[model samples]
Target chain A: MASYTERQAGSRLADYLSERAQVLSIALFFAICILFFSATTTTFLTTGNLLNVVRQAAPILIVAVAMTLVITTAGIDLSVGSLVALINALAAILMAAGLPWPVVVVLMLVAGGLIGGVQGWFISYQGIPAFIVTLAGLSILRGFALLLTEGYSIPIRDAAGFFWLGRGEVLGFPVPALLAILVAILGFIVMLHTQYGRQVVAVGSNMEAARRVGMPAKRVLASVYVVSGVASAIAGMLIAARLGSGSSNAAQGFELQVIAAVVLGGTSLMGGRASMTGTVLGTMTIAVIGNGLILMHISPFFTQIVTGTIILVAIWMNTRLFDRNWRFARRKPS
Target chain B: MMAAEAQATRGRGDAPLPPEPILRLRNIHKSFGSHEALRGVDLDIRPGECLGLIGDNAAGKSTLSKVISGTYIPDVGEIELNGRAVRFSTPSEARDLNIEMVYQDLSLCDHVDVVGNLFLGRELKRGPFLDQKRMLAQAETMLAALEIRIPRLTAKVEKLSGGQRQAIAIARAASFEPKILLMDEPTSALAVAEVEAVLGLINRVKARGVAVVLVTHRMQDLFRVCDRVAVMYEGTKVAERAIGETDLQELVDLIVGKGGH
Candidate 1:
C-alpha cells in the first residue's frame, strides 16, 4: 500500500481542527502575549510575578477544567460564578454566626454540590439548554449572595484559620495554589483514566452515536456541571477567605475569563476533546495579560480590546487550519 | 427446495397460495402521498435462500429495504412472518423478530473498538456493568468463524479497511443470531479485493442457514453470490429469475425497463 506523506498528515491535522479552529488560534495568541509581556514589562520576567500569575490562575484554572468538560459537550454553565458566590456567602454567614470554621467549610462544599445537582438536572435531564438554565441560576444565586450580605461585604473579623486557606503559604507558596494544582491533576486523572471521562467526551463528540453505543450521555453532561458546581463553591470559599470577606461579585466576568483560558489552551467549544493542560495555561495567560496590562498602565478598556482581539485572531487561525479537513466531509450538500 | 419444486409442477396458477409463503405480502400498496414510492409493490423473502434485490435509480430499493428494517412503515401493507401478522413500530421491534439490516454506513460508531461496536445498544451485561471480556470472546469467535483476519480485537472500527468493516457488520448481525439478514449495497464502496473478501463472508453466513437478501447495483456481483434474483424497477419487482438463467444485459433491461419487453 502507498503511504500517507507529510502532506497527508498535515491535511489530516487541518481537517481535525476545522470544527474548533478557535482553540488553536487562541493558543497562538498566548505565545504572542507572553512574548510581548516579556519584552516590555520590567516585572514580567521575574520568577516572583510569574509564580504570582500561576498562583492567581490556580482557582480559575481548576474551574476551567469543569468548563472544558462542559464546553466539550457543547454546553455552557453561567451559574459557576454565582455558585461560588452563594457557597462562600453561606460559609461567611455560618462562620460569622459563631459556627466552627471547619463545619462552615464542609457545609459550603455541600451547598455547592446541592446547587450543582439542581442546575445539572435542569440542564441535562430536563432537556433544558445549559446556557439558559445556568444563566437563570446565576441571576438567582447572585441575588442570594446579595441577600446574605445585606448590601455589604461579609468581612471575617478574625478568620485566622479560614483565611490561611487563601493566604497561608506551604513551602513559600500559597495553600490555595497548591490545592488548585492537586485538583487540576485530579481533573486530568478523572478525564483520562476513568470510563466516565471517556463517556463524557464520547457524548460531547456525538450524542446519537453515543446513545446508539449505550453510553449515558445526559448523565455525563450532568456530572460535568456537578463537578464544576462543587469546584466553583470551593473556589468561592477560598476567595472569601483570601479577601477576608464574602463577596457577591468577587469573580464578576470570571466565567468568561475561564472559558477564554480553556479556549486559549486549545479546548474546543464543539465538545468531545478537552485539554486540561491547555486550560491551566489559558488561566495563567489571562492572569499574566491582566497583570501585565496593569503594570503597563493600559486602561481597562484597552485591556478588554486586547483580549478580545487575541480571541478573534485565535478563532480565525483555528478556522483556517480546519478548512483543510472539509474536503473529506464536503458532501453533495444534502 | 422440494416444496418450491412441487409448486412449479402444479402450475403457475397465480392462486391465493398454500399455507402462507414463509413471508406473505397482501397486495402491498405503499405510497408517499401523491407520489407513490412502492406503488402496490409486493415481495416475498423465503427461508434459507439468498435473494438478489436489484433496481435502477429512484426505483425505491432503499425505501423498501427500510420498510423491512422498520426505518419506514409502508402506507398500506401487511407483513406476516412465520404465519403471524406483525407491524414493526421500530427497527428494534423488527430486529426482535429475527430481521437484521446492513447498510453502507454499517451503523458502527467509529470511535469505539470492535467488541464495543458489535455489542452496542444490546451489549451483554454482567449486572449493571458491560461484560467486556464476554463480548470480546464472543466477537473473536464470530470473526474467526467468518475467516476474517483482523489483528487487533481492541482496534477501532475507523481504522478498519472497507472489507474489514463489512466483515464486522456481518459479524455483528450474525451474532444477533438473526434469521434473515438484509444487506443494502454492502459492496458499493469496496475495493476489488475487499469485495471478494465480503463475497466469501456472505457465503459463510449462508452456510450457517441464515437467509440473506442483498440489494445491489452491480450485475456481476449477482452472478457471483445470489442463488435467486428479484429485479425491481420503479418500486415493483418486474422480473424474477434463477441466478443461473439471467444474463447481465437481461438483468440491465429488467432494471432500466427494456429486457421484459
Candidate 2:
C-alpha cells in the first residue's frame, strides 16, 4: 500500500519563533527605543512621562486598533482622519447648540457609522476599490468639516461629564489611556476568539473561498469600515473633550499615523494576517519616538523624518529578516 | 452483469432498482456568452459509488461539476436529489443540501490555520466566540480518520506543502459528511505516495455511501477507485462505461474524440 511519509516535526522553539517573527521583532524594536530614550534622558523613564506618553498616544491607539481590522480585511480607510475632523467639529457644534453631551456622543457615533456604511457600500456592494472610495471620503468629509466650522475652532463649554471621558483618571491611569487599552483588549479578543474575526481573516485571505464555503463575505468586508468609523468617532470625541474645543483642522494627517502604526505592528497591508499586540507596540513605539525626540533636545520637525525612517526600516525588516518563513538555522534531514 | 443492466437503463427515464441514485442530472445545459459550456448532459450518481469524469480541456467537465456543486446555475436542466426536483441559485444552497465541491485550486485561505480552514465557513462557535478547544479536538479526529498526518493543527495553511495542502482540502470536503462530494483534479499536484493516500481516502469515503464525482485526467486513477466512468467531448457526455467494461485505450480515445461514437 502506498503511504505518505510524515514530515518530522521541527523544533518546537523554532516553530514558535517563526510564527511570531513579526511580533517579536517589533517588540524588540519597542524595547530598544525605550532603552535608548531612558539612557539618554533622566526624565524619560519617569512614571509621569510614561503615563503622559500613553495618554497622548490614546487617540491614535484607538483608531489604530480599528485600522488593524480594516487592514486585516485587505482594506484601507483613508477617510478616518477626515471623519475624525468632521466628528470633532460636529461634537462641538452640537454641544454649543445645547444638546446634551451624552446625546451628542451617541449622535456622533451614529453619524460616523452611517458615513462609514456609505463608503463600505460603495466598496463592497458597488464593487468600488476601498482606496478610491475612502480617498474620496477623505476629501469630501474634511471639506464638510471645514464648511461646518468655517475654518475656525469651536469651543465646548459646560460639558464636564463629557470632558471626564477624555480627561479623567481611573485608578491613577489616564482615562484616555485606559480606554485605549480596553479598546485594544477588545480588538484583540475579537480578532482572535470571535467568529467575526475569523470571517474577516477568511474574507481577506480568499473572498471566493470564503464565499464558496457560505460566508457572508461582502458583509464582512463592509463591517470593518463601520468599525473604523466608530473608532474614529471615539477618538474625535476624546480630543474634543481633552482640549475643550473642536476644529475642522483636528487630526490632520491622522490617517497616516494610524496606518503607520498598524503596519508597524506587523499587520500585513496585503491582508489576512493581524496582531493586536503588534499594533499596540507599534502605536506606543511611534508615540515614544515622537515624545523621546523632544526630550533629547531634537527639533520637533525632525521627528517626522525619524518616524518615516523607522516605518521604512521596520517594514523592510518585516518583509526581509523576520518573514514567517525565515529560520534561525536550517534543519538537518533525518 | 449488474453493470450491463445499469448502463442499459441509464438516460432512458429511470430504472426500477433496489439501489436508487442519490443525485440525478437530466439534460443539463450551461453557456457563457458565445460559448456553450455544457449541452444536454445527463448523469446519475448512486450512493456509495465513485464516478470518474474524464475529458480534455474545455470538455465541460468543470462546468458540469460546478453545476452539481451549485457554483453555476445551469441554463436549462433538472437536478433531482433524493427524487425531488431542485434548483440551486448559489453554492450555499447546495451546501445546505449537503453537496460539497473541492476545486482544482484547493480554495483554502492561506492565512488561516489548519483547524480553521477545515471548518472555514461552518465554524463551531459558542456564544459568539469560536470554540477553539472543541474545534481543535474535532479537527484532530477528522484528520486522523482520513489517515492524514500534520505536524501541528495550528500551523498556517501557507506553511504546508502542496500534497499536504491538497490533503487538507480533501479532508475539509470529505469530513463534512456531504451527500455528494465533487472533486476537480484533486490529485494533480500530489506526490505519488500522496496520490495513493487520496485514492485510499476516496475508497474510504465511498464506503460511507456518499456519491462522489471525481474529474481528473489521470486515467489510472479511474480504474483504481471509480466504479464507473463518463467521458465528455466539447460540452457533451459522449460515453459511459462500468469499470470492468472499459479499457484505458477506449477512455483515451473517447476523451480525444477519436473513437467511433
Candidate 3:
C-alpha cells in the first residue's frame, strides 16, 4: 500500500538552486563589482590590468583556497598572515645564506606543515577551540618573525629561479596567476570528488556522527590546519620571490582580506558548506575593487574603509537575507 | 488471527532446534560513577526475529541497547556472537561484527547528499577519490532493495521531511546487511503513515533473518512487528514474553511494575 504523506517531490531545478543559493548570490555580487569597475575606470577591463590584479591576488588566492578547507571544517586560521611573514623572512634568509632555492622551498613547506601540526594538535586532540588556537598562533608567529628580522627587510639576491616563480610570464599570463588558477581548480576537484573532501564536510556537519561511523575525525580536523600551513608557506615564498626581499611587516592584516574573500564567497562560518568557485570569484572581486579604487584616484586609506564596508554588507546579506526564506526568482504558476 | 498465530508457530518450528542465538548477553552490568545503569541483564537474540525493548524512561532500556551496540562498555558482562565470545571497546568494533544501531538523533549529515550520507563512513573509493559513479549506482540498488524513494539522491538530508529522513536512516542501517540491527525510537517523530512505513521496514528486515532490536515507548508497534517483547525496569530486564501471549495492558503493567506477577 502507498504511504499517505503530504510532502511530494520537488523539481530537481529547485533543489539545485537551493543547494547552490550562496554560490549564485556571490557570483552576482562579483559580476556587479566587475561591471561597476569597468564602467567607472578607463583601464579596469584591460587584459594587462586584469592580469596584474590576478598576479597580485595570487598569494591570497592560494592561502584562501586552503583556508576554505579549514573554514569548511568550521575552523579558522587567523595566524595565516603571520605564518606567511615568518616563512617569507625565513625563505629569504635561507636563500641569502647561500642555500639552493629548491632546498629552501622544501624546508619552508615542511616548517609550515610542522607549525600547523602543532596548532592542530592543540585544537583537535587537546579540545582547544580553533579560533583560540589560531588567534594565539597569530601572535606567536608574528612575534617570531619580528624577532628574527629585528624590524628590518632582508634582501634576497641571486635567486633567479625563485624570482621566475613570482615574476615570470607564461603564455601571456602571469605565472603566479596561472599557479593560483591551478590551485583553485585542484581545490574544486578535491572538495567535490575526493574521499578526503567528503570526510571534511562530514566532520564539519556532524563530528560525532563522523566519529561514530569510524572516520578519523580528529585527524581530519588536524590535517586541515596542516594544509593551511603549507599553503601559507607557499604564499610566503611567492611574496619573497616577487619582492626580492622579505620583511617582518609583510602581509599585515592579510588574514582579514583572505577571510573576507572566503566568507563573501558564501562559505558558511558555521561550517559544513564551502564553495571553491565562490572563493575564486570572491578573491577576484576584492582584487578588482582595490585596483579600481586606486585607479579612480581614491586614497588607499579610503579603499580600506570601502573594502571593510563591502565585506560587512556582503556577509550581512549572506547570513541574514539569504537564510530567511529567500529564493532567486520564484517559478510562476503555469 | 488463528492463521497468523499458526504461521508464526510454524516459522518458529522450522528454525534450528534449540536455536543458538546470533547474539547473547549474560550478566551485563554497567555503572556510571555511583549510578548503576544496568544490573546483570541477560538476553539472547535469534535470527529472523524482532525483539521489542520497552520500558519507562531511566529503566535501562536504552542503556541495555547501548551496551549491546558498544556505545557503552559494561563493567562486567559476557557477550557471544554465534557461539563465539566477543568483546567490543568501540562502536566501530561492533559495526565490524555486522552490528548496526540507528541512534536517537538519526545521525544524518545535513550538508551531504542522500547518496553520500548512505555511504557516509564506508565510502567507495578509487585511488584516493570517491568513486561517485559506482557509488551512485550502488546507492540506487540499495534504496531500491529497501523500497525507499528519495526522489533525488543528490538532495541534502536537511531538505527532507522527518518521515523521509527516518526512512533514509533506517534504509542506511538495513542496507548494510547487518546481523543485529538496533533502532532507538525510530518512529518517535513520524506521522501515522510514516510510522506504518517504518513498521513495514522492520517486518521486511525481520524476514531477512536479521536479529532486530526495536526500542520504543510506542507499545502498539510491538504487536505488529515484534515476535517477542522484553521489558526493562530500573537497570534490569523485568520480563520477556512471546507477542501472542501478552496484551498491551500486561506490557503497560510490566513497564509500570504494577500488575505482572
Candidate 4:
C-alpha cells in the first residue's frame, strides 16, 4: 500500500506559540510601555488617570475594532478620520435644526453607511483599489465637514440623554469606555466565531479561491468598509456629545491612530490575520504613551515622534521577527 | 476539420460498450478570441472507471476539461449528464449537478485552517456562527476516509507540505460525493512517494463509482490507474484506446501527434 509518511507532529505548545507570536510580542511591548510609564510618572498608575486614559482612548478603540476587520481584508480605510469629522459636524447641525437628538444619531449612522457603500461600490464592483477610493474619500469627506460648518465649531445644546451616552458612568466605569469594551468584545466574537468573519479572512487571503469555492468574495470585501463607516459614526457622535459641540477639526489624524493600534496589536496590513485582544492592548499602549508623556512634563509634540517610531518598529518586527513560521525554540532533528 | 472528424469517428468505433457514462461530451467547441481552444471534441466518462486525458501542451486537453467543469462555456455542442442534456453557464451550476474539479493550482486558501479551507464556501453555521467543532469532526472523517494523514486539522494550509496540501484539495473534492471529478495535472509537482499516494487515491475514487477524468503528461501514471485513455491534438480528440490495448509509447506518440489516424 502506498502511503504518505506524515510529518512528525511538533509539540502543541510550540504550534500555539508560533501561531500567536505576533500577538504575544505586542502584549509584551504593551506591558513594557505600561511598566516604563508607571515607573517614570507617579500619576500614571493612579485609578483616576487610568479611567481618564480609557475615556480618551474610547473613540480610537471603537474605530480600531472596525479597522481591524478592514485591514484583515487587506484593505485600508483612509477616510475614517474624515468620516468621523463629517458625522461630528453633521450631527450638531441636525440637532441645531431642531431634529430630535435620537433621530439625528440614527440619520448620521445611515448616512455614514450610505457614503461607505458608495465608496465600497467603487472599490469592489468597479475594481478600483481601496487606497485610491478611500484616499479620495479622505479629501472629499473632510471637505464636506469644512463646507457644512464653514470651518466653524457647531454647539449641540440641551440634549442630556445624548450627552449621557458619552459621559454617563455605568457600574462605575466611564460610558464611552464601556461602549468601547462592548464593541471590542463584539468584534472579537464576530472575527473568531462567525461565518462572516471566515468569509472576510478568506476573501483577504485568496479572493480568487474564495470565489471559485462559491463565496461572495466581492460583497464581503465591500462590507468591511460599511463596518468601518458605522464605527466612525458612533465615535463621532460620542465625541460631539462629550464636548457639547462639533468641529471639522475633531479627530484630526485619528485614522492613523486607529490603524497604528490595529497594526500594533498584530493584525497584518497584508490581510487574512488579525487579533482583537492585540488591538485592545495596542490602543491602550498608545493611549498610555500619550498620557504618560504629559504626566512626565514632556513636550506634547514628542508624542507624535514616539508614535511614528513605534509603528515602524512594530511592523518591522511583525514581518521580520514574528513571521508565521517563527518558533520560540527550534526543535531538534529527530 | 475533415481529418479531425475522421479520427473522432474512428476512435468512437473502437470504444467498448460499458455502463452508461455519467457524463458525455459531444462535438464540443470553445473559442477564445480568434483561437479555437476546443474544436469538435467528443469524450465519455463512465462511473467506476478512470479516463486518462493526454495531449501535448495547447492540444486542447485543459480546455476540454475546463469546458466539462464549466469554467469555460462551450461555444457549441452538447453535454449529457446521465443521458440528459444540460447547459452549465457557471462552475457553481456544474458543482450543483455533482461535478467537481481539482485545479492545477489546488485553489486552497493559504491563511485558513485545513477544516476552514475544506468548508470554505459552504461553511456550517449555527445562527450566523461557524460551527467549528462540527466542521473539525467532519474534516477528520473526510480525510480519514481518503486515508490521508495530516498531523493537525487546525494548522493553516500554508503550514502543510505540498503533498499534504494536494491531498487536502483532492479530499475536499472527493468528499463532495460528486458523480464526476476532473483533476488537472494533480501529480505534476509531487515527489515519487506522493505520486504513488495520489495514484492510489485515484483508484480508490474510481472504486467509489465516480467518473474520473485524469489530465496528465505522465504516461506511466495512466497505466497504473486509468481504464481507458483519450488523446487530443490541435483541439480535437484524435484517438481513444482501452488501457490494456495501449502502451506508454503509443500514448506518447498520440499526444505528440505522431500516431497515424
Candidate 5:
C-alpha cells in the first residue's frame, strides 16, 4: 500500500507520448518501406500483394499481442513459439482422426489455455521466475510436439476452409487482419475497462502493495499467462491452416520475433503498462519490414538486421525522451 | 486509579463526558521471548471519542494498538468489542466485526486513484468488473461528509500533499463504517500546518460516532484531541487520567517510571 511507488506527475504524460511515438514511428517506417519498395519493385504495393503481407502478419500479430501482455507483468514467455508448434501438431492429429472442425478448434484453444495455466501457475503461484517457467516450457512443449509426430510432418487435405482464416478476404481485407483488429480491441477493453485488467497492471506495477490490500495476486498473474497461451494456440492454428501442414519444426524461433514485435511496439517487458494498439503497430511494422526486404531483393537474413536496428533505435529514443521528461537523468556523482 | 477514572466516565453527559466508553481492556499481558511489550495494560475507548496514547519510544503504544486490533494475538487477556468478547487472528477478522486500523505510512497505493485506494483491499465490484464509477462517487461522498477539501477524485495519491494523503487514508478507514478505528501515529512526518489539518480530520472522525485509539508520541496532539490521556511506561499503563487533570510533566514522569524511585 504505502510502499507502492507513485510515478511523478507528467511522467504519465511522458509515457503516453512515448507509447504514441511508437505508433508514429511504425507509421513512418511503413511509409518508408512502401516508398522504397514501390519505387524499386514493379508491383510492390499491389492490393493482392499487400493482402499477402497482412496474411503473413496475422499469426505473428496474435502471438505478439499475447507476448505484450505477458511482458507487461515484467515476465516473458519464451515457450510461445513451441506452444504454436505443439498446437500445429495437435491440429493435424485431431483433424486426421476424423474430429469435427468445431471440436478440433475447441480442443486447440483449451490446450493453449491449459498450457498457460500450468506455466503461469508455476510462475505466479509457485513463485518461480517467468523466464525459467517459460524457458522450461519452451523445451518441454517442443519435445512433446516432436514426440507426437515422431519428428515428422503431417499434412491436412481437408483444411481447405480453414485456409481462408489465414488468406480469405472480406470485402477485400484478409480475415486474419480483421481478426487481429478484433483481438486488439478486446485486449484494450479488458486492460482498460475491467477490474481484472486493472488488477493485472496493479499487480505488475507493485506486488507487495497488492498483497497487503488482500488482492488475489496469484490469480491475476496466472490469468495473463493463460491469455498468452490461448493467443499462441490461435496463432498456431492460423499458421498451420495456411500451410495445410502440421510440423514440430513449424514456428521455430518464432518466440523471438513475437517478442521483438511486442517490445518494438512499445510494451514494456518489465511489466505494468501495455498498449494493444502499440502491439498492433509493432506487428504491422515487422510485417512491412519483412515484405519490404523481399521487394528489395535483399537476402532474408537482412530482415532481422533491419528490424533489430529500427527497434533498438526506437527504444533508445523512447527511453531518452522518457528520461528527459522526468528531468529524470540519473547523474552519477562527478 | 484506572478503575476510578473508567467508572467516573460512565456518568451522564457533559461531566467532561468522555463520550460513551465503547471498548474496555483489562490487564492485557503479552510478551515476546524475554521482552514484555504489554504488561498488564488497562484502557477504555468511548464512542465518538479520541483517546490519546502517549509515552516515550518503546512505551508500547503501537504494540498496544496491534493487540487491540488483532494484528498480533495477545498471549494473555480478553478484549471486548461493544461489551462482547472478541479474539482476532487476522485484521480482516477484526474488520468484518467493524474494526479498522490505519497505519502511519497510510498504506495508500500510489498507482491507483483515490477511490480505488479507498476500497483498496476491499473493492466494490459489479458482476465481473470493478465498479470504478460507483466507488469514486462513494469516495467523493465520504470526503464531502467529513467536509475534506480534495480537488478531484481522479487525483493519484502521489500528487497529493502530506495532509491530503492522510485525509484519504483516514477517510478510507472511517468510510468502512467501522465501530472502532486504531490510528498509529497518523501525523508523525507532517509539517506544522499539515499536523493541524490532520487534527481537524481527527475531530471530524470523532464527530462521526466512531471510537478511535489515537496512538502518538507527541503530547501536544494528545492534549489537543484526546478525550483522556493514557501514559504507557515500559509496556505498562502507569497512569491514565482525564486530560484536564493531567500535565506534560506528570505524563513524562509516568513514561520514564519516575526514575530511581
Candidate 6:
C-alpha cells in the first residue's frame, strides 16, 4: 500500500489578511484622511459640507462603479470624459429643441449604449486594443461635441422634474448623493452575488479558461463597455441638471477622476480583482481631499496638483507595500 | 488486484468480451497549417482501466488527447463514445457527455478560491446568488472523498502549492462522475511525494470504473497505475501492450524506435 505525506496546513487568518490586505490599507488610508481633514478644518466634518461633497462627487462615483467593471476586465475606456461631454451638450440641445425632458433622458441613454456598443464591437470582435479604440473615440466624440455646440454652453430652463435628479433633496439627503449610494450598493451586490458578476470576474481572471468552460466571453467583454457608456450618460445628464446648462467642456478629464477612484478603491488594472466598498471609500477620500484643501484656504488650482500627487503616492503604496507577499509575524496557532 | 481485475472482466459477462471501449478514435488526422500533428491515429480506452499514452516530444500525444477532449476538431476521423459515433464541435460538448480533461497547465483560475475553481464554469447558484454556504459544504465533501486535505477551502488557488493545485484539478474532474478522464502531464512538475499521492489518486479513480487516458513523459508512472501502455512515434502509434505482457525496457525501446533483442 502506498502512503502519501500530508501537507502541513497554514493558519486561515493569515490567508484572509493577505487576500484583503489591499482593501484594508485603502480603508486605513481613507480613515486617516477623514481624521486629518476634520482636524485641519472645522467645517470639514459638518453635515452640510459632507452632503455637498457627496452631491458633487455623485457623478464620478456613478461612472466609477461602471469603470470598476471595465478595469476588472483588464480594459480601459479613455473616451468616458468625452462621452459625458457629448451627452451633456446633446441633452441641452435636444431639450432646447422642445424635446420632452423624459424623452431626452431616454434618447441620451440610448445614444450612450449605441456609442459603447460600436466601440465594444471593434475591440471585442475586431480585436483592436481597447486603449487604441477608446483613445480614438476620445478624440472623435469630443470633436463631435465641440462641433455640435460650436464650443458654447446651452441653458436648461423650466424643467424642474429634470433638475430634481441632480439638485433635489430627499429626507435632507441630496438626491444625486442618494442615487450615487444606490448605484454603489447595486454594484457591490452584483459583483458579490450575481451570475453576471461571476462571469465578469471569470473572464477577467482567465479569458481562455472562461471560453473553454463555455462562457460567452467576447459578449461579456463588450457588455462591460456598454455598462460604462450608460453610466457616463447618466453622469453627464446629472452634471447638466446640477449646473442647469450643458457645455462641450463639461466633465473634461472626468475619465481620469473616475479611473483614479476605482483604482484607488483597489480594483486592479491588471484585471481579475475588484472591490466596490474600496471604490466607495476611494471616491469619498478624493472628494474630501479636494474639498478640504479649499476649506483650509489653499488655492483651488493648487488642489489639483495635490490631488495628482496623492493619487501617485497612494497607488504606489497600494501596489508595492500592500500587494507584495510578506508575512507579518509568525502565523498565529489556530 | 488480479482478482479485482478478473471480477471487473467477469462483471461485464462470461461471454468473450471484445473490449468495447468507452471512447474510441479511428483514422484520426490533424494538421496545423503545414504541420501534421496527428496522422491516421487509432486509440481505445476501456472502462475500469488506465491507458498510458507515452511518446517523444511532438509525437502527437497532446494533439490526440485534444481531439478526444474536443479542444481540436480532427480533419478526418471517427470518434465513438460508448460504441456510438459522436462528433464534438466544442470542448463544452465533450464536457456535457462527462469527458473531462485536465490540461497540462491545470487551467485553474488563480484569483478564485479552491471552492470556486472546483466549480468554475458550472457554479451552484440559488436564485441568482452563488450559494456560497452550500458550495463550501459540498467542496469539503468533495475534497474529503478524494482524500485531498486542503486546510482552507477559501484559499485562492494561487496561494496553494503546485501539488495541491494539481490535486484540486483532478478532484474536480473526478467529482463530475466523468466516464472518461484525460490528464496531460499531471505529475510532471510534482515532487516525489506529491507524485505518489497523485498515483494513489489515479488508483482510486480507476477503482470506480472510469476510463482514464494519461499522457505523460514519465515512463515509470506507467507501471505504477496503467493497465496498458500505448507507444507513439512521430504522430503514429507504434505499439500497444498489456502491463503484464511487457517491461519498461521493451516499451522504452519501442518509443526510441528499436527492434527488440
lDDT of 6 by residue, B9-123 (tens): 5544532464678888999999999999999999989987889999889999999998998889999999999989999988889999999988887888777789988887888
Q: Kindly report the docking quality category of candidate 5.
A: acceptable
Tens digit of per-residue lDDT, candidate 5, span A1-334: 3676655445556545543555666567667767878888876789878888888888888888777768877788999999999999989888888887678888999999999999999999899999999999999999999999998898877766777776678998888888877887777777766777667766876665565455677788888899999999999988888788889999977887787787776666556657677787777777877887787788998887877776677567557744422233565799
Greater-lDDT candidate between 3 and 6: 3
Q: After superposition, how far is residue A46 of candidate 2 from its true place, in Å?
A: 1.8
Among these predictions, the greatest DockQ belongs to 2
Assess the local accuracy of residue B255 in candidate 2 as a C-alpha lDDT between 0 and 100. Answer: 91
Report, for every candidate in turn, its global Cα lDDT versus the true structure.
0.74, 0.90, 0.88, 0.88, 0.78, 0.86
Deviation in Å, model 1, residue B32 alpha carbon? 11
Q: How much is the lDDT of residue B170 in candidate 1?
A: 66
- List model 6 lDDT by residue over A93-197, tens digit each: 999999999999999999999999999999888989999999999999999999999999999988999999989999999999998999999999999887788
TM-score of 6: 0.91
Checking candidate 2 for backbone clashes, the offending pairs are none
Task: For each candidate, report its DockQ versus the true two-chain complex.
Answer: 0.15, 0.79, 0.70, 0.61, 0.31, 0.58
lDDT of 3 by residue, A65-112 (tens): 999999999999999999999999999888888999999999999999
Superposition TM-score, candidate 2 onto the true structure: 0.93
What TM-score fits each model?
0.69, 0.93, 0.93, 0.91, 0.80, 0.91
Ranking by DockQ: 2, 3, 4, 6, 5, 1
Ranking 4 against 5 by TM-score, winner: 4
| Candidate 1's DockQ | 0.15
Per-prediction TM-score, chain A only?
Answer: 0.86, 0.94, 0.94, 0.94, 0.87, 0.93
What's the distance in Å from true for residue A175, model 2? 0.4
User: What does the lDDT read for residue A256 in candidate 3?
Assistant: 85
**Residue pairs in clash, model 6:** none
